[model samples]
Target chain A: MQSNQELEGFRVELRDWLEANCPAEMRGGEASESSICWGGKNFEFASDAQRDWMERAASKGYTVPTWPVEYGGAGLNRAQEKIFKEEMDRIGARSPLDSFGIWMLGPALLHFGSHEQKLHYLPPIARGEIRWCQGYSEPGAGSDLASVQTKGEDKGDHWLVNGQKIWTSYADKADWIFALIRTDREAPKHKGISFLLINMEDAGVETRPIKLISGASVFCETFFTDVKVPKHQIVGTENRGWDVAKYLLTHEREMISGGGQGLSGGRALGAVLNESLGEGQEMETTLRADAMRCEVDALATGLTLERYKDQAEAGTGAGDASAMLKYMGTELNKQRHELLMAAGGSDALEWDGPLGNRPADWLRTKANSIEGGTSEVMLSIVSRRVLGLGA
Target chain B: MANLVMTEDETMLADAARGFLDKSAPVKAFRDLRDAGKTHDAKMWKEMADMGWAGVLVPESAGGSDMGHAAAGVLAHEMGKTLVVSPFLSTAVIAATALRNVSDARAEKALAAIATGDVTYALAVDETSKFNPEATSMVATREGNGFRLSGKKTFVVDGALADRLLVLAKTDDGLTLFDIPADRAGITRNAQNMIDARDSARIDFDNVEATGEDVLGQVDSAMSVLKPAIEAGQAALAAEMAGLSAGAFGMTVAYLKERKQFGTVIGNFQALQHRAAHLWCEIEVTASAIVNAGRLLDEDPDNAIMAVSLAKARATSTAQLAVQEGVQMHGGIGMTDAYDIGFYMKRARVGAEWLGDYGYHANQVAKHRGF
Candidate 1:
């Protein structure tokens, strides 16, 4: 509700606050695959300080700026939120919260959560008190996402959840999970699904870490043995969970696509390539052209993201168009990483410290085209929805 | 700044062009034109002109859409989709842009007529295979009241069919541009058949007469005018290349999905899927670059020159890769003359080599960066 002048004034004040509070040691530091953190998860050194900062910012609704002020968000317009991000990025200020709750569940809840549900959940998420993980992709269902067989049986007062989810990122570390379960056995595949929110600490919940090619155990296989979730935790109408899942997938794709842009604090692709390739490697004329081409694409994709963000703020964001952006962005990011790995050559294959880590990181990026939705699935969406090709 | 982003109006125009080309300019038409050794489809050209495509980039004051380069590029992209062979690029975009940029009233009127489908023009710039406009090899000297143009211009695009020719020549002062009528005395045209079956001509000008009025812009500053035109031309060609690459990639994917090999559709193979996915990514990236260049051209003409160079260089490489991979992925069927994939690949090669090859544009970009 603030005027443009008021927003500008707030930006200046926020910039000064960030400059004073952000730790100098945290600035310009390399991000590890394990921890892109200035402080640990326990908030050891500045635990109270970080918590206070988070609480103050959340109280002002700055943590989720575009969310309503009544719902514990800053209620800032898109331009103001952009300025907030710019200032925070400029000062190297780390986010108080970095979890699926902040990125995925919060947006879905805002759209589909009941008033009581929003009141109960939005505050805790905004305050960085809860970490959420996704439970959508099952062992049997990967790219054919709607085929999830996780069952949520009605048990009168509460629903009993029983099934397993694979590729559940941070499931062990998460405080809660938003899952898609089959609620109607006789109905069609997509129509039978339901979206439910469950506590990770519930009696029958379990998680086992899944080690990846990157050697990082970032994801897990989550199991629910008669896990009980309260009836109120179901998002939207029962058996319409597929709709909520689809909506959440859109947000997840947006997050993944946007993730490519802010990696390692807005470093230019050309700078990254030059740094990795070294001074006199004799970049073939063809390779130089390819690099410039990639750079142009990154810039264009970034601009497209900005344009779409503006649309989202205006409440007119195209749902399927986000898929197009995500599809293009993740693939481009993978290509960029591929180029970096190739430029690094044998050095990229080293796996000891940070130098040893590049190869693993590069290997992990191969999931970019597979995760969220397979690149093939994204194209099908584009051809059918955006271009109206297959009808 | 002109809105280089495609608006609804522009998208509608592009869709209309696509529909027309799909229904009218199919693969058979392209083959017929090639077999007949024709440069363009006469009926299809008239239809496109009737749709006001020839004037898509001209100013509204000159009885054209004044839509600008971005819209023109979109139209050309659709044309590239069906491989609609014509002088649309040479007459509508290149020649018209040259005349418009010159800011001469007479030239504007001539361009207006071209937009109305009553006139057509071609650019005679390339003297050799290299992309150096400065080394024109054509000379113009002062004579009584006008000027005499003397030179041999090869690969003059649509030179045989053009009503007017915009000739780049060197004068005593410096390089200049002259608007010479095709019927001028001592102007001889030798029509040449191109590899892709496009129309081109080797023009010989033996003391052709010209006046100051026919000189576009400043007499000695043709390079300035020529530079932007070349960039615009390159950008348009890149857009076309994007379309051609997309179509070819789509056909390959379709073929892969249908063709059974080893008791399964070839598309299901992990290796082929990966390759196809990579090519799709390349096409998307190239498209993003070309679209961005077009948008930048509308916003900043100067920066657009660099963007165009970058785009064309990238597109040339990417298109070649896409077509080669597309054909290889299709196996022997892709190599057959009956298959349309070869046509797309041939068109891509012609488009890539038209303005400058990948190496030339890369060097241009490097030079711009002070390398």
Candidate 2:
């Protein structure tokens, strides 16, 4: 571990730099989809301040601070990255960019992609020049992700793809997609799958937004009809994409759990409820008690996450333990929003106005348990893998 | 306030405690002691004191290892897993904490005696069913150079066997704490037959006399010493409950793997597996809260209210879940006296109401969180 003095010095320097570079407009704002910069080739910035903030942060590789400099990152260690995040949070600095490429695909590529492939893709992701969407869940496969039937037939120089992928979050807006394709039909289900990168702009590709209970089209049903993909675009072994896909799923689970923290941001639910009630007003005891329990559980979840990080630093990785985090965090997040809705009361029933996207947010949290992996499947995985329970 | 993970020395101490407890005082020992109708075993407590656990919070000058609260929690947690019947929490944690706050010669001697296992103490509070020490109705009227204590303290844990007692009594100023012998004149000790089969008493202090030397800290500010002691005990009890949960959950999981239903192992059923997994997740989260509580009490005891209450609340709820699931999954065997799962259920029930129940702790946390 580095000395506290050294970390303190670095934090001071980082704080000064953030103060000088971060736009005032970029700080102290709720992280909503409209204000976020996805930064694809066709993405228009919400404002000049948003564009400037992302470019300045990306130039320093703060978007993916822990990745190596050669891979378009600041080359920070874990402690430094934590310090960077803490400093960013102190000033209420909004994340310059949000995309699947940075969270999910970048980690998978860093571990399994070829050097040439990393150089070609990682820089664009770090700089937010490209947006990526995951295509692991097909129309036929959700929990049984390895059983995806998206066909990728080899044709000497290229591969022909034909299948449909559902729940491709932000797929209509993504520039590229990382998909699991079935290349070997006669082999075992898991053995036949391959992870391939596809350009969304390519011919015979289509995307249609799926309306959700949240009244927003955050996900799309992406279709690949006779699409051609270069043979070299495959990640890891051709028929062993399941390994890379599984590894990526771990990152996705961590990210989903982290999404709870993003929303929580250490804001007290009691205070939120008090504000909703418009001052000098007392929240009902039952609702207040429920909110406190949720807050306490959220705090516990946060501590659990920190403990796991410390354990991983001590050379004991939380392998299957991440499942517990996802299940609890998502559940707690939903509970928090549910309390928020109840706190809002009749005013909460309104679609818009003073309540501010909370009704939509509460409904959106429903997807947290269903997406990535359902809570039921997560429990099954924990039982089988972590506990080693046998038939 | 402190590191979420234990230090190297703390982890080593925990390993040693686990090894010794598993070997010497496994669940069988608890069962045997119960069969003999003994709520506590002085011989086993002497062995623990010989191993330096009785002085975990005491200073080296007072014949202790001074291993801190986290280390004490580690030992207590291990004892909890085996349902070790002892006075470590009441004597080592609470009594030591109370003694450490005041540096009087008697308190110092008491601390040294506690470290040596020559004496044990229990706090005499809770006049009613609940544990609101501030609501103490026990009055001590000034009589010459001493005071006469008159009150009944119900649910005085470890009071049955403790050599000394820390009694809370209302004085003209406010609430005052008196440290005196349990065998003092006019003090009647009638031990209760708790469902958990633990050493608890409902004592009637009929004008029990206490001198100025017996007063710990200032007269009216007894909370200065008593509050920390109680909080220390609460955190350790929380740690114990966390371990008890893990122990019960472990037994349940093992049973699930072995028990067969409909020609298949019961563990293979999704119904049972999900419940087991959900319980495991609850235990894991509660473990972190317990760890944080220990850390906070060690580093920032003044500001540890939120963390300590959360730990106790989470541990109480999770332990309840573990024992309930344990019994439900174990079928008829769980209900039989021959099985050890019932012991955990009883202990968890006792722990939930010990320092403070779930609602009490949650109220504390809610206040800290500005609810």
Candidate 3:
């Protein structure tokens, strides 16, 4: 545990270090899909400078700063890690890698994986040597996630997986998937599930990219036909996969909620609103009020997040309150993008090249309310669990 | 950006006020206050004064804690929860604000008295059912040693009980605020029973005399002080409305869980659950808006007008929806006097219309936009 003074000092040091090391070219402006470095089996870079930048950050473990040193991480404590994030933000440093391996799978593996699992999976995840995508949602089991029909039958020495996963983000580019499969069809929907880590190159595994309104193949329909997942890859208890699924869902919600700050590149929401809507137009009143309302809600949600982060740093988890935050934050995020589209008006309709994706990006935000747990589900959880409204 | 969120100290103050209100001024206290036709409770006022709530916003140099408007908003919020019948808002916030903004020696001294709970004052600003303080029709004419004020002020909060009335009057220079003693000759206070049962008054200032030294601000510069003071008042009212909405929403939720319909808790139904969730979100957003307005009021008075107006509009709509939906969700018991929801709904209506209605504030915001 570090004092506020110590944290401030660490922040200043990290600030200085980032200022000297980070290249001016790899800074603040938005990175296209081509510019983004996803270091997996298929990783490539257009320029030697970009490749060198990725290698430098990866070698120093700055790519995953807070992960354990043994797995190519700086191993900084929570406070120091926060300071590192703030410093990186201050210097406008671009992340060396952006993938499910870094954001979703890494944390889940750290928490639930065996020692062998951690050693094999984490180093690659930290080194940006693997790209992962989620395999959770199905056409029939969107919000009612417990009703997943994906099955994993145990063979003599391996597990045979057979089912379809829809809305699997980045499945087309992913090298691995952490999925949920029913190991016992006779058991209850929740009890029959099991967590399995699967290789994307396994025989009979297929991925078809879904063309989203955002003009990008960010999600895909993944089908597993007799795909063999090594028995050793089963995480936690085979029959008790629901617990692992619940844990992952919490992290997923947090990740989606955290996505709020990442969408708008370093610009204050107020500034964006002002630019989109000309100053003091009569027609802009409703839009201005809505934008202001969203801004205030964002601030409130952000402050609530900071409070939770503080508590987490102090080793006191907010538990169900995190659900409250996730619910509010995702709604606020959707509202923000809606306001942006409203502000952009006709200009928002124009989609070509990169700008073509703006409309899709806006449409993708609509999924936020539906995914992770529909807004309705979150509210029900809050009412029953947090508010104690139902016994 | 002095953390718009509540600090530990602010939370402690809020919790203490909440605890006191729960124990002392329950729904019964509100009933008693309303039934007795009393504008405020002296015992509760003394308890609050003892707790230093009255001095929460007043400068310490003027016998106050000088904590600022954020703390005052918190106190008002707790007051709303208990439906505490008091002139805390009218005297401590509105009048004290006018005095503080005026920044005169006499006004400062008056504020000191207010901070100490030794005196109470009401601002007589509203006339002709408008939110504009500059539209005041009360006249202040030059007289021998001082001035004579003549005209009427409607819906003066706590007018019958206030020791001093900070009357907004039109002088030859322009609109001015005059602190006329309620007991002064030619002053008549007729107590009016509002729909919410809160005590207000129609005050007639028939050539009431007051010295130029009693003027609140530079003779004609009352608009500067009045506008911001009105904004602050609206913000405080919005805070109270937020608290009231929270209370009503909480009560409705509790009743819904306990009162079964169709052999299951009403709360178990998806329709009721979604409705309650939406109301909760609305209240949460309203709370943020009001708190933001309070912060703006303290830091940037120039933007306070817009912030407060926006907050008032949001809160008025939020409170109205929460109360109406709360009652509907609670079933038939909600409309009965025995249930607490009706009282909250009435109080919310009063708050919504107090400084300005939602439409009025929205129009004001548009006008401020130069539309």
Whole-model lDDT per candidate? 0.76, 0.88, 0.77
Q: Which one is best on lDDT?
A: 2
Candidate 1 vs candidate 2: the TM-score winner is: 2
Ranked by TM-score, the better of candidates 1 and 3 is 3
lDDT of 2 by residue, B236-314 (tens): 9999999899899989999998898899889988888899999999999998999999998888899888888989999
lDDT of 3 by residue, B1-371 (tens): 22345667778989888999999988788898777767677777777777787777688888887777777888888888767888888888888787788776787788778877888878787777656675777888988767889998888877888888888888887888777788999999999878778878898888788897877777877777777667778888888888888888888888888998789988888788777877776676567667767778778878677668767887888889988998899888887888788999999988987888887776655454443
Residue B159, model 1: Cα distance from true site in angstroms:
2.7
Every prediction: chain A TM-score = 0.89, 0.95, 0.89
Predicted model with the maximum DockQ: 2
Q: Which pairs clash in the backbone of model 2?
A: none
| TM-score leader | 2
* Clashing residue pairs found in predicted model 3: A214-A360, A351-A356, A352-A356
Evaluation by DockQ, superior candidate among 1 and 3: 3
Q: Candidate 2 at B104: error in angstroms?
A: 3.7
Fnat computed for model 1: 0.05
TM-score per model over all chains: 0.79, 0.95, 0.80
Encode model 2's per-residue lDDT on A148-251: one tens digit a residue.
98899999888899999999998988999999999999999989989999999999999999998888998999999999999999999999999998888877
lDDT of each residue in A267-331, candidate 1, tens digit only: 55555556666568666565566665555556546656665665565567758876777787787
- Poorest 10 consecutive residues by lDDT, candidate 1 chain A: A36-45
For residue A236, model 1's alpha carbon misses the true position, in angstroms, by: 2.2
Global lDDT of model 2: 0.88
